[model samples]
Target: MKQILKTILLPLFLITALSLNNCATIFSGTSQDVEINAKPQGTTIIILGGTIGKIIRYGAKIQSFIDIFSEYLDEEDKKVLERYSFESLITAVILEVRGVVPVERSMSQEVAKVLAKIPRSYKVKVLNTFGMEEFALAPVKTELKTSGGYAVIGYMSGKKIVVKEINTRLNWTILWNVLNGFILLPIDVLTGAYKKLTPLELDMELNEPGEKLSDYQAQGPNQKILILVN
Candidate 1:
């Protein structure tokens, strides 16, 4: 009787614990918690500069890129090039769009917005600019169990392909949306990446920097863990 009860009770206890924790984030804590200061509003965009030649070397057409990039900008923003004032040069833009996305990292559709869209590449023109530079969005996300009953997070990312040729530069951007299932603040911060960005958006601190991104390192259906692919 004692042996039978032990086995049954053990299973019950495990089940109970799992049920209680089900609503909470199973995989949390990816970014390093640096002393967070007040970051400037809409300044310091992170650009993931990829060589146009390389992205072409991989799969991904050029036309699809323009459409994706176009969704991000408005008619007014397009005129930014002409405005080129001290503050109106469109300054520098961040590449919030990324390459391929893995499953489970999608976000809520309501809050996401496309500010600017860049069509796909027409030629290797943009690809050759990087001189074989390695580039892609640095995956970052933070899930906060707020004091209130709400989850608060911030994230930013984008797609950037630059074709470099000594002086002449060409670039084509694309669209990439990761973590669409129930994510709230991906426009500000990503939940999958465990680092918190500082007041200045340029740098981030991942406390456990050594941890592997997502849970997988390979490709195809065999891949179980999500990844920030280039």
Candidate 2:
């Protein structure tokens, strides 16, 4: 009786351990660590300004219109509408009207004519603005989500030096669950543990405007410039 009980419990324990060990959710996790450094070691890195977010926001608006008026739009028309924001759509229509930006072969002429007649507004600005949130000084390690986002590395003076986009890829480590009959695959997929953030490290060179190469040569190779942002 004692031997039978041990045999039954031991196999159960081993199977449970194996399943957990092979699961990406338990072993690899959902977020990845990225190390970022700059040529000027103290330069600031900021997360801001991405076209992906805009596309997604406008796509949902276009999708709603498609669902309501299914008969009016074909597949090509839906694709064109979903790709642009209201401002961008208006600009494109105006350009098509003026023969500036060529109208695509698939674009409907009637739709373009209607869109071009809408009122246009222009606000002149020297520099584009974006909300700055989450920043770090370089030669630093940070954990980024296994989802997509954008980042900009710049000086404390607010001049953008480099723009980097973070994207996701499949985490092949989840394939290890094949040995466990893929029992834990659902958990990994649901928790996003099956994805990994690309470009695990960043080494960026800064281009400081109006600074000659001779200016940096005089400062010597070991000189460090630290700019603080409050």
Candidate 3:
């Protein structure tokens, strides 16, 4: 009788725990992290989101017009839209609507001139390699600090409290449920691990402070900026 009770009761507990774990991943998710290090004391550092955010907003605005047209679209129009992946189209529109705008900061002409005279190096870390499609549309929060006279350090990145998991596969955690016992329930819940983000890293070095940002070539990720100074 005890064995029967264990068999029935244990799987239910595991299922319940797993459901909560999945829900947490879907909702809370993980925050983006960027580590910054810059040189020269009192060197001004500026971090801003790039054109990707702007493009998304423009796309969403355009999609809104498409939605209006859809109301009048005939069967042929429906077929045309059907030719495209529904998930892809919707995700594109959603990302744009929720995309983060770059922060705007300008230097006074006199201050800019003074900094231009000082020679220094620059680094920008673009944390994710794939793309900005996954980030939630929101403003990035910036924090600034001094790291010795040679460098300034801080964290800058947008938050996506809720995110959709894409191109993901089942993992050992989910498979562990096959064991079907109370013993594994706690282990699964405590580990509850899942892949949530694919972030790229961008490292840039400016030979001198006098050089313009456009002069440097950077690789990895679009729309997201890990480090920038202007």
lDDT of 3 by residue, 19-44 (tens): 43332122123233333322232222
Count of backbone collisions within predicted model 2 = 0
Q: What TM-scores do the predictions have?
A: 0.18, 0.32, 0.25
Clashes per model (N, Cα, C within 3 A)? 57, 0, 12
Ranking by TM-score: 2, 3, 1
In TM-score terms, candidate 3 sits at: 0.25
Once fitted onto the true fold, the runs of candidate 2 whose alpha carbons sit more than 4 angstroms away are 1-28, 49-133, 156-160, 169-199, 208-230
Best by lDDT, which number?
2
Lowest lDDT sum, 10 consecutive residues, model 2, at 220-229
Q: Candidate 1: lDDT of 90? A: 12
Which scores better on TM-score, 1 or 3?
3
> Please, what is the whole-model Cα lDDT of each candidate in the order they appear?
0.24, 0.38, 0.28
User: Which structure among the candidates has the greatest TM-score?
Assistant: 2
lDDT per residue for candidate 2 within 77-174, as digits (tens), equals 66655553332332233334334343342134545533333333221110122222235678767765444443433332222244344334222343
Model 3 residue runs over 4 Å out of place are 1-4, 7-70, 95-177, 180-230
lDDT of 3: 0.28
Comparison by lDDT, 1 against 3, better one:
3
